[model samples]
Target: MPTPAPSASTPPPAPPATGAAPPGLPPGPPRTPPAPPSRARRLAAPVATLAGVAAAFAYVGTVDPNEPGHYPVCPLLRFTGILCPGCGGLRSAHAFARGDLVTALGCNALAVAGYAVFAVVMAVWLVRAVRGTPSRVTVRPVWWWVLGAVLALFTIVRNLPVGSALAP
Candidate 1:
Protein backbone atom coordinates (compact mmCIF):
# COMPACT_ATOMS: atom_id res chain seq x y z
CA MET A 1 0.00 0.00 0.00
CA PRO A 2 1.11 3.54 -0.78
CA THR A 3 1.63 6.13 2.01
CA PRO A 4 -0.25 9.46 1.90
CA ALA A 5 1.70 12.67 1.14
CA PRO A 6 1.94 15.48 3.74
CA SER A 7 0.71 18.98 2.83
CA ALA A 8 2.59 22.30 3.28
CA SER A 9 1.86 24.14 6.58
CA THR A 10 3.01 27.62 5.48
CA PRO A 11 -0.46 28.98 4.53
CA PRO A 12 -3.67 27.86 6.24
CA PRO A 13 -6.55 26.95 3.93
CA ALA A 14 -8.21 30.14 2.63
CA PRO A 15 -11.82 30.82 3.76
CA PRO A 16 -13.09 31.31 0.21
CA ALA A 17 -10.42 33.61 -1.23
CA THR A 18 -13.13 35.98 -2.54
CA GLY A 19 -14.55 37.71 0.61
CA ALA A 20 -12.57 39.92 3.01
CA ALA A 21 -12.59 39.41 6.82
CA PRO A 22 -15.16 41.66 8.58
CA PRO A 23 -14.30 44.94 10.36
CA GLY A 24 -13.78 43.66 13.94
CA LEU A 25 -11.85 40.48 14.86
CA PRO A 26 -14.32 38.40 12.82
CA PRO A 27 -17.87 38.56 11.38
CA GLY A 28 -19.60 36.43 14.02
CA PRO A 29 -20.46 37.36 17.62
CA PRO A 30 -18.21 36.07 20.44
CA ARG A 31 -19.09 32.44 21.11
CA THR A 32 -21.00 32.14 24.36
CA PRO A 33 -21.53 29.03 26.51
CA PRO A 34 -24.89 27.35 25.89
CA ALA A 35 -27.85 28.79 27.80
CA PRO A 36 -29.60 26.67 30.48
CA PRO A 37 -33.23 25.60 30.20
CA SER A 38 -35.93 28.25 30.08
CA ARG A 39 -38.54 28.16 32.85
CA ALA A 40 -40.96 25.82 30.97
CA ARG A 41 -38.50 23.19 29.66
CA ARG A 42 -36.72 22.84 33.00
CA LEU A 43 -39.90 21.99 34.93
CA ALA A 44 -41.69 19.87 32.30
CA ALA A 45 -40.30 16.34 32.80
CA PRO A 46 -40.09 16.50 36.59
CA VAL A 47 -43.63 17.82 36.78
CA ALA A 48 -44.88 15.10 34.46
CA THR A 49 -43.10 12.37 36.42
CA LEU A 50 -44.46 13.70 39.70
CA ALA A 51 -47.97 13.82 38.26
CA GLY A 52 -47.71 10.24 36.97
CA VAL A 53 -46.39 8.91 40.25
CA ALA A 54 -49.14 10.75 42.13
CA ALA A 55 -51.74 9.29 39.80
CA ALA A 56 -50.34 5.77 40.20
CA PHE A 57 -50.18 6.11 43.98
CA ALA A 58 -53.71 7.47 44.07
CA TYR A 59 -55.09 4.65 41.94
CA VAL A 60 -53.36 1.95 43.95
CA GLY A 61 -54.14 3.69 47.22
CA THR A 62 -57.89 3.84 46.64
CA VAL A 63 -58.51 0.53 44.89
CA ASP A 64 -58.00 -2.72 46.78
CA PRO A 65 -55.73 -5.12 44.90
CA ASN A 66 -57.22 -8.18 46.66
CA GLU A 67 -60.54 -7.69 44.89
CA PRO A 68 -60.92 -9.38 41.52
CA GLY A 69 -62.71 -6.59 39.61
CA HIS A 70 -60.82 -3.58 40.92
CA TYR A 71 -57.48 -4.41 39.32
CA PRO A 72 -56.37 -6.55 36.42
CA VAL A 73 -55.16 -9.85 37.79
CA CYS A 74 -51.70 -11.04 36.83
CA PRO A 75 -51.98 -13.65 34.05
CA LEU A 76 -49.35 -15.84 35.63
CA LEU A 77 -51.43 -16.07 38.81
CA ARG A 78 -54.72 -16.56 36.98
CA PHE A 79 -53.62 -19.24 34.54
CA THR A 80 -50.61 -20.94 36.11
CA GLY A 81 -51.63 -20.61 39.77
CA ILE A 82 -48.18 -19.24 40.58
CA LEU A 83 -47.04 -15.98 42.11
CA CYS A 84 -44.69 -13.83 40.01
CA PRO A 85 -42.18 -11.47 41.59
CA GLY A 86 -44.37 -8.52 40.57
CA CYS A 87 -47.39 -9.99 42.32
CA GLY A 88 -48.86 -7.80 45.07
CA GLY A 89 -46.67 -4.86 43.97
CA LEU A 90 -49.73 -2.55 43.78
CA ARG A 91 -50.81 -3.59 47.28
CA SER A 92 -47.25 -3.16 48.46
CA ALA A 93 -47.06 0.37 47.07
CA HIS A 94 -50.43 1.20 48.57
CA ALA A 95 -49.34 -0.10 51.98
CA PHE A 96 -46.05 1.73 51.60
CA ALA A 97 -47.78 4.99 50.72
CA ARG A 98 -50.12 4.43 53.69
CA GLY A 99 -47.16 3.93 56.10
CA ASP A 100 -47.75 0.22 56.72
CA LEU A 101 -44.30 -1.30 56.50
CA VAL A 102 -45.25 -4.83 57.56
CA THR A 103 -48.06 -5.08 55.01
CA ALA A 104 -45.75 -3.69 52.34
CA LEU A 105 -43.10 -6.35 53.05
CA GLY A 106 -45.79 -9.06 53.12
CA CYS A 107 -46.82 -7.87 49.66
CA ASN A 108 -43.47 -7.63 47.85
CA ALA A 109 -40.00 -6.87 49.20
CA LEU A 110 -38.48 -6.39 45.75
CA ALA A 111 -41.06 -3.75 44.85
CA VAL A 112 -40.06 -1.74 47.92
CA ALA A 113 -36.43 -1.90 46.84
CA GLY A 114 -37.50 -0.77 43.36
CA TYR A 115 -39.30 2.25 44.80
CA ALA A 116 -36.24 3.22 46.85
CA VAL A 117 -33.97 2.83 43.81
CA PHE A 118 -36.36 4.94 41.74
CA ALA A 119 -36.36 7.63 44.43
CA VAL A 120 -32.56 7.74 44.45
CA VAL A 121 -32.39 7.91 40.65
CA MET A 122 -34.97 10.70 40.56
CA ALA A 123 -33.06 12.62 43.22
CA VAL A 124 -29.93 12.40 41.06
CA TRP A 125 -31.96 13.50 38.05
CA LEU A 126 -33.32 16.52 39.92
CA VAL A 127 -29.83 17.52 41.11
CA ARG A 128 -28.47 17.31 37.58
CA ALA A 129 -31.37 19.35 36.24
CA VAL A 130 -30.86 22.08 38.84
CA ARG A 131 -27.13 22.14 38.07
CA GLY A 132 -27.89 22.57 34.32
CA THR A 133 -26.11 19.33 33.58
CA PRO A 134 -27.40 16.67 31.19
CA SER A 135 -29.11 13.79 32.99
CA ARG A 136 -27.81 10.40 31.91
CA VAL A 137 -28.17 6.75 32.91
CA THR A 138 -25.89 4.10 31.58
CA VAL A 139 -26.01 0.36 32.39
CA ARG A 140 -23.85 -2.27 30.79
CA PRO A 141 -25.56 -4.99 28.72
CA VAL A 142 -24.17 -7.60 31.14
CA TRP A 143 -25.84 -5.82 34.03
CA TRP A 144 -29.12 -5.83 32.14
CA TRP A 145 -28.82 -9.57 31.52
CA VAL A 146 -27.91 -10.19 35.13
CA LEU A 147 -30.90 -8.16 36.32
CA GLY A 148 -33.18 -10.14 34.01
CA ALA A 149 -31.82 -13.42 35.27
CA VAL A 150 -32.20 -12.35 38.88
CA LEU A 151 -35.82 -11.28 38.38
CA ALA A 152 -36.60 -14.51 36.54
CA LEU A 153 -35.04 -16.58 39.28
CA PHE A 154 -36.84 -14.58 41.92
CA THR A 155 -40.14 -15.14 40.14
CA ILE A 156 -39.53 -18.87 39.83
CA VAL A 157 -38.38 -19.32 43.39
CA ARG A 158 -41.13 -17.18 44.88
CA ASN A 159 -43.79 -19.47 43.37
CA LEU A 160 -42.26 -22.62 44.84
CA PRO A 161 -43.50 -23.99 48.20
CA VAL A 162 -39.88 -24.16 49.42
CA GLY A 163 -39.54 -20.40 48.95
CA SER A 164 -42.90 -19.51 50.51
CA ALA A 165 -41.46 -16.47 52.28
CA LEU A 166 -40.57 -15.01 48.88
CA ALA A 167 -44.21 -15.42 47.81
CA PRO A 168 -46.59 -12.51 48.00
Candidate 2:
Protein backbone atom coordinates (compact mmCIF):
# COMPACT_ATOMS: atom_id res chain seq x y z
CA MET A 1 0.00 0.00 0.00
CA PRO A 2 1.25 3.58 -0.79
CA THR A 3 1.44 6.08 2.12
CA PRO A 4 -0.27 9.48 1.71
CA ALA A 5 1.99 12.60 1.82
CA PRO A 6 0.98 15.69 3.86
CA SER A 7 0.67 19.12 2.19
CA ALA A 8 3.95 21.15 2.68
CA SER A 9 2.66 24.28 4.43
CA THR A 10 4.60 24.01 7.77
CA PRO A 11 7.63 21.85 8.48
CA PRO A 12 7.38 19.13 11.12
CA PRO A 13 8.78 19.98 14.53
CA ALA A 14 11.80 18.01 15.77
CA PRO A 15 10.80 15.32 18.29
CA PRO A 16 11.75 15.84 21.95
CA ALA A 17 15.36 14.61 22.05
CA THR A 18 15.12 13.19 25.57
CA GLY A 19 13.39 10.35 27.43
CA ALA A 20 12.99 8.07 24.48
CA ALA A 21 14.04 4.42 24.71
CA PRO A 22 14.58 1.55 22.27
CA PRO A 23 11.79 -1.01 22.11
CA GLY A 24 13.24 -3.29 24.83
CA LEU A 25 14.99 -0.61 26.93
CA PRO A 26 13.72 1.44 29.86
CA PRO A 27 13.49 5.24 29.56
CA GLY A 28 16.39 7.19 31.04
CA PRO A 29 16.28 10.27 33.30
CA PRO A 30 15.87 13.71 31.68
CA ARG A 31 18.94 15.84 31.04
CA THR A 32 19.60 19.11 32.83
CA PRO A 33 22.36 21.70 33.06
CA PRO A 34 24.19 21.96 36.39
CA ALA A 35 23.63 25.18 38.34
CA PRO A 36 26.36 27.82 38.33
CA PRO A 37 28.46 28.14 41.46
CA SER A 38 27.58 30.65 44.18
CA ARG A 39 29.42 34.00 44.23
CA ALA A 40 31.57 33.09 47.26
CA ARG A 41 32.31 29.64 45.83
CA ARG A 42 33.41 31.13 42.53
CA LEU A 43 35.52 33.84 44.19
CA ALA A 44 37.24 31.59 46.72
CA ALA A 45 40.02 30.18 44.59
CA PRO A 46 41.08 33.45 42.92
CA VAL A 47 41.04 35.32 46.21
CA ALA A 48 43.02 32.65 48.03
CA THR A 49 45.55 32.50 45.21
CA LEU A 50 46.07 36.27 45.28
CA ALA A 51 46.44 36.23 49.06
CA GLY A 52 49.10 33.52 48.91
CA VAL A 53 51.03 35.43 46.25
CA ALA A 54 50.83 38.63 48.28
CA ALA A 55 52.10 36.80 51.35
CA ALA A 56 55.02 35.39 49.42
CA PHE A 57 55.96 38.81 48.06
CA ALA A 58 55.70 40.26 51.57
CA TYR A 59 58.06 37.59 52.90
CA VAL A 60 60.49 38.09 50.02
CA GLY A 61 60.40 41.84 50.62
CA THR A 62 61.17 41.36 54.31
CA VAL A 63 64.04 38.91 53.72
CA ASP A 64 66.74 40.27 51.41
CA PRO A 65 67.97 37.65 48.96
CA ASN A 66 71.14 39.78 48.51
CA GLU A 67 72.18 38.64 51.97
CA PRO A 68 73.95 35.38 51.08
CA GLY A 69 72.94 33.44 54.21
CA HIS A 70 69.21 34.13 53.75
CA TYR A 71 68.62 32.23 50.51
CA PRO A 72 70.16 29.15 48.94
CA VAL A 73 72.54 29.63 45.96
CA CYS A 74 71.21 28.26 42.68
CA PRO A 75 72.57 24.72 42.34
CA LEU A 76 73.23 25.16 38.61
CA LEU A 77 75.16 28.38 39.28
CA ARG A 78 77.05 26.84 42.20
CA PHE A 79 77.95 23.58 40.41
CA THR A 80 78.25 24.38 36.71
CA GLY A 81 78.69 28.19 36.93
CA ILE A 82 75.83 28.44 34.40
CA LEU A 83 73.10 30.98 34.96
CA CYS A 84 69.64 29.40 34.63
CA PRO A 85 66.54 31.37 33.62
CA GLY A 86 65.51 31.55 37.28
CA CYS A 87 68.94 32.36 38.74
CA GLY A 88 67.95 35.65 40.37
CA GLY A 89 64.16 35.11 40.71
CA LEU A 90 64.07 35.56 44.48
CA ARG A 91 66.19 38.71 44.30
CA SER A 92 63.95 39.97 41.50
CA ALA A 93 60.88 39.30 43.59
CA HIS A 94 62.49 41.06 46.56
CA ALA A 95 63.28 44.12 44.46
CA PHE A 96 59.84 44.09 42.89
CA ALA A 97 58.14 43.98 46.27
CA ARG A 98 60.27 46.90 47.44
CA GLY A 99 58.99 48.96 44.46
CA ASP A 100 62.40 49.03 42.75
CA LEU A 101 61.27 48.19 39.22
CA VAL A 102 64.67 49.05 37.70
CA THR A 103 66.57 46.79 40.08
CA ALA A 104 63.94 44.04 39.67
CA LEU A 105 64.43 44.01 35.91
CA GLY A 106 68.18 44.28 36.32
CA CYS A 107 68.17 41.24 38.61
CA ASN A 108 66.09 39.11 36.24
CA ALA A 109 64.27 40.64 33.29
CA LEU A 110 62.56 37.35 32.43
CA ALA A 111 61.25 36.97 35.98
CA VAL A 112 59.98 40.57 35.90
CA ALA A 113 58.15 39.82 32.64
CA GLY A 114 56.69 36.74 34.24
CA TYR A 115 55.51 38.83 37.20
CA ALA A 116 53.75 41.26 34.87
CA VAL A 117 52.09 38.42 32.94
CA PHE A 118 51.02 36.81 36.21
CA ALA A 119 49.51 40.11 37.40
CA VAL A 120 47.51 40.54 34.20
CA VAL A 121 46.26 36.95 34.26
CA MET A 122 45.34 37.14 37.95
CA ALA A 123 43.45 40.40 37.41
CA VAL A 124 41.47 38.86 34.55
CA TRP A 125 40.83 35.75 36.62
CA LEU A 126 39.58 37.84 39.56
CA VAL A 127 37.22 39.80 37.30
CA ARG A 128 35.89 36.63 35.69
CA ALA A 129 35.46 34.96 39.08
CA VAL A 130 33.47 37.93 40.39
CA ARG A 131 31.27 37.79 37.28
CA GLY A 132 30.47 34.13 38.01
CA THR A 133 32.31 32.84 34.99
CA PRO A 134 35.02 30.21 35.26
CA SER A 135 38.48 31.29 34.17
CA ARG A 136 40.42 28.97 31.87
CA VAL A 137 43.92 29.29 30.47
CA THR A 138 44.40 27.58 27.13
CA VAL A 139 47.70 27.87 25.29
CA ARG A 140 48.22 26.22 21.93
CA PRO A 141 50.93 23.56 21.67
CA VAL A 142 52.79 25.74 19.15
CA TRP A 143 52.87 28.62 21.62
CA TRP A 144 54.22 26.30 24.33
CA TRP A 145 57.00 25.20 21.98
CA VAL A 146 57.74 28.80 21.07
CA LEU A 147 57.91 29.73 24.76
CA GLY A 148 60.27 26.81 25.41
CA ALA A 149 62.47 27.93 22.53
CA VAL A 150 62.49 31.48 23.85
CA LEU A 151 63.53 30.25 27.29
CA ALA A 152 66.27 28.10 25.79
CA LEU A 153 67.53 31.10 23.84
CA PHE A 154 67.47 33.26 26.96
CA THR A 155 69.41 30.60 28.89
CA ILE A 156 71.97 30.24 26.09
CA VAL A 157 72.47 33.95 25.43
CA ARG A 158 72.74 34.84 29.13
CA ASN A 159 75.71 32.52 29.40
CA LEU A 160 77.51 34.02 26.38
CA PRO A 161 79.76 37.12 26.70
CA VAL A 162 77.62 38.95 24.10
CA GLY A 163 74.59 38.54 26.39
CA SER A 164 76.36 39.53 29.61
CA ALA A 165 73.67 42.20 30.08
CA LEU A 166 71.01 39.47 30.25
CA ALA A 167 72.93 37.54 32.93
CA PRO A 168 71.84 37.89 36.55
Measured against the true structure, the TM-scores of the candidates, in listed sequence, are 0.77, 0.80
Off by over 4 Å in 2: 1-33
Q: Residue 26 in model 2: shift from native, Å?
A: 10
Candidate 1 worst ten-residue window by lDDT: 12-21
- lDDT against the true structure, per candidate, is 0.81, 0.90
Candidate 1's C-alpha runs over 4 A off are 1-34
**In lDDT terms, how accurate is model 2?**
0.90
Q: In candidate 2, which residue pairs get closer than 3 Å at backbone N, Cα or C atoms, i.e. clash? A: none
Tell me how far the alpha carbon of residue 76 in candidate 1 is from the true structure, in angstroms, after superposition.
1.3
Steric collisions counted per model: 0, 0
